[model samples]
Target: MWFFSIAGVGVIGVLIGGVCLMAQRKSLFGVLLSMEVFTLGVYVVIFSMVWFLSGLNSICLVFLAFGVCEAALGLSVLVSLVRSTGSDYVGSLVLGHF
Candidate 1:
């Protein structure tokens, strides 16, 4: 029951994040934020599953490492984008692309 609830929330989070990503693809910050949310949902789902199953100890650690790497990469991309554009607006950045 708890597993299903957590998984459901994660699925919803992913859907919302996907929509945000598709709508704001031009903005680096928006993309990064959306990705973060999506990843967090994934982590939540996985964590719940692991907790319910009483799985391997290393699984959670591995997920944590992945999350850290993702955050670092996302932040780096956002910084580069901001440096180049001087604005965080997705629409403006996308308009400049062409």
Candidate 2:
């Protein structure tokens, strides 16, 4: 049924996000990627719920706008940090570096 399909997608998203987050130990890029995966999962779940409740509307649009902005800002910051430090390793970002 449709309900099962939705739940399956939600579960898959959560699993993907969890796996990506676990990979974050390798590099800052991994961390960002994982966060994006997690965000995707959140979006999927929210949109699904909204779709079931009231069809589509401005709420989905607003959530999408904010999600895009968040991802952009996060990636920009990551790029800046990498450029300044010459490395994407998580530990490279120490308080004293700033």
For all predicted structures, in order, the TM-scores are 0.79, 0.82
Q: Write the per-residue lDDT of candidate 1 for residues 1-98, one digit (tens) a residue.
A: 77899888988888888888788756677788888888878878788888889887688789889989988987876677677777766566665562
Highest lDDT: which candidate? 1
Query: Cα RMSD to native, each candidate?
Result: 3.0, 1.9
* Model 2 agreement with the true structure over 10-90: per-residue lDDT tens digits: 768878988889867758778777777777777777777887787767777888888899889988888888898988887
* Best candidate, TM-score: 2
Global lDDT of each candidate: 0.80, 0.79
Look at candidate 2 and tell me the lDDT of residue 39: 76
Deviating ranges (above 4 Å) for candidate 1: 89-98
User: What count of clashes does model 2 give?
Assistant: 0
Candidate 2 matches the true fold with a TM-score of 0.82
